[model samples]
Target: MNYVLALFLPPLSILLIGRPILSIVVFLIWVPAIIFSGGLTHPMFILLAWILIYQAHQDRRAR
Candidate 1:
């Protein structure tokens, strides 16, 4: 299903790519995906994605 795929793909891709910018982009992409998929009730998951993105950016800046 598109909803399931959308939910998983962005995070997985970010993990695979290992890039902060890409992960941030992926997290941004999830906004619309969640909206259209009617998954906004799972806001915590979105927050987790944001946390990952933030950590990635922090790591990049530290390097």
Candidate 2:
């Protein structure tokens, strides 16, 4: 569910994964990057969010 959400809302996905600070940073960077770069940079943030989500899941599973 969050992985699928990451595909669309990267910052929100990051937040959902439990990284409030990082999510805020991503939100700040992502919106402007998308606006300025015409969405070219969005994929990078999406990938970052996905990686964060995966790591969070792994951590959860390990617990």
Candidate 3:
């Protein structure tokens, strides 16, 4: 699942760095993740993880 993680990396990077451009890049990556992993995995877990990571990034930026 390296490819799956890799897909998330760009968006994760953007989230941590607080770059809108990178965030857009992340979305691009996420699209495939959604397509490939969506039916295979638990959607709630994926969504929760994303929200948690996003919130954590935002909190870090606010600090």
Candidate 4:
């Protein structure tokens, strides 16, 4: 679900994963990067979100 969400909305997915500050930073950059670059930069954010999601899951498993 979140992977799919990350594909579409990386910042929101990141926020869901519990990183408000990063979400804000990604949001700030994602918008213009999308607009100007025509989504070429989107995969970067998606990858970032996916990594964060994976990390969060790992953290839960560790705890």
Q: Which candidate comes out best when scored by lDDT?
A: 4
Ranking of all predicted structures according to TM-score, beginning with the best and ending with the worst: 4, 2, 1, 3
Tens-place lDDT per residue, model 3, 1-63, is: 975784565456556645567577547656766678763443543564477578877898999
Better of 2 and 3 by lDDT: 2
TM-score of 4: 0.85
TM-score per prediction, in order, is 0.43, 0.82, 0.36, 0.85
lDDT (Cα, tens digit) per residue for candidate 2, span 1-63: 853443349888888989999989988887777667777887799789889989998998999
Clashes of 3: 1
CA displacement after TM-score superposition, residue 19 of candidate 2 (Å): 0.7
Alpha carbon lDDT of each predicted model = 0.67, 0.81, 0.62, 0.85
Tell me the deviation in Å of residue 36 in model 3.
22
lDDT of 4 at 32: 82
- Which pairs in model 3 have colliding backbones? 11-26
Spell out the clash pairs found in candidate 2: none
Q: Which 10 consecutive positions of candidate 4 have the poorest summed lDDT?
A: 1-10
**What's the C-alpha lDDT at position 2 in model 2?**
52
**Among all windows of ten consecutive residues in candidate 2, which has the lowest summed lDDT?**
2-11
What is the per-residue lDDT of model 4 for residues 1-63, given as tens digits with 9 covering 90 to 100? 843553349888999999999999998998888778877987788889999999999999999
Using TM-score, give the best candidate's number: 4
Q: For each predicted model, how many residue pairs clash, with residues at least 3 apart or on different chains? A: 0, 0, 1, 0
lDDT at 36, model 4: 81
